[model samples]
Target: MIADDLSSKIRGGELSPGVALPPQKELSARYGVTLATLRQALQQLEDDGLLSQQPGRGTFVAEPRAAYRLDSLRGFAEDLRAQGHLVTTQILGQTVAQPPAWAAAHFGDADPAVRLERLRLLAGHPAVHQVSWIHGLELAETDLSGVSLYAALAEHGIAVHRAGEALRPGVLDQASATLLRQPLGTPAFHSERVTYGLDDRVLVADRATILGSMMEIRTEREVSGLSMQWVQLG
Candidate 1:
């Protein structure tokens, strides 16, 4: 297909987010040209973050970029401290076990000996609980205790390519209610995540249910092609 034509379609939102584009072979056949022609088109789209290619999953239209400014949200500790709230983490749990079911699978064929887990706090309140899993298998020695998981991963030169979050509301489960100090069955927000490594490998899966009473979240995406899907119950 003509690069100009393809670019116009994307710009017009005709080929919207999460929509898959025709395969290179198909585009080639339709455009009556070589695969190289199609690759050039896909390259341009990818550079713009409007299209994504997954070898096994094929290519698909990307979602809109979010507008949540990373700078506006105070870092966990600083934000709470600013409010005069003491932030402390009791280390409710820590382990380097197999990635939990919630974590995105790293390498489809990785051996079972790789994962990272932690329970974190904000203002002495349980705010983030996480598990990181990756295929490097070499990642077992990475210390994640009180260190930000992202920081630890970066120390080893592993940059996260992109990540997605799925949030939903639910009555707190027994364990969650107890931890977050809500009455049994109180409402909560479960933020589930699937983080990816620079190579597009799933690197972490996290399930954190926060007290809904204290937080409201909003994100805007029109440039980065990342997405956050959330449901509100309270």
Candidate 2:
């Protein structure tokens, strides 16, 4: 947990870039944990590519952030293909419950949440992890397992009006790395997007962190019709 907190602070920009953390001894004292525990935490962070240890230079944080252009919206699947990558999804599990706080907000304060976990693949390589939540009643009659999620909703008369998104860089722990098939030190993209129906009615929300190896995105200013860009993840 200490290691995770440290990673979060550094990733969240609380520690800032080029910031040098205290020596192991000082960190141990400050956190009130033993040297062994401190080292363990630090090791975990290093494994997640959040930090680099310098034999005589202590440890330095890593720097990596996706440069998103201001002009376009890239759908996850289409974006992967635009990059000449193939995107695939492995639906891991699904459950129904009250939507989590974040999902609740996106789904118009849904009383029931449909949670789905999927592993995203880019060109045959496991990339981002996807966790989608939808309003239960809205999707209750839908048969998932295949087909685009956005399409499924539309078929049910849910008109997708727009989507809202948030993004941040975060360290990859063992579990996340394992899921992405990368070493623990890899960087992951934490992202959240909420889709709204017509009249801005909440339809569904998806949250995920794409692995670095998967994609790149930028928006373009077009004078006329729609213009799109993407590179498939798998």
Question: How many pairs of residues collide in model 2?
Answer: 26
lDDT of 2 by residue, 37-65 (tens): 99888888876657778788887785543
Off by over 4 Å in 2: 1-75, 82-84, 108-110, 141-143, 222-234
The 0-to-1 C-alpha lDDT of every candidate, in the order given, reads 0.60, 0.71
Q: Pick the candidate with the highest TM-score.
A: 2
Worst 10 residues of 1 by lDDT: 66-75
Consecutive 10-residue window with the lowest summed lDDT within model 2: 64-73
Candidate 1 TM-score to native: 0.53
Please state the error at residue 193 of candidate 1 in Å.
0.8
User: How badly does each model clash, as a count of residue pairs?
Assistant: 13, 26
Report the C-alpha lDDT of model 1 over 11-107, residue by residue, as the tens digit.
6868876788887888889888899878887888876666788898888876533221222322233444554444554444444455444442434
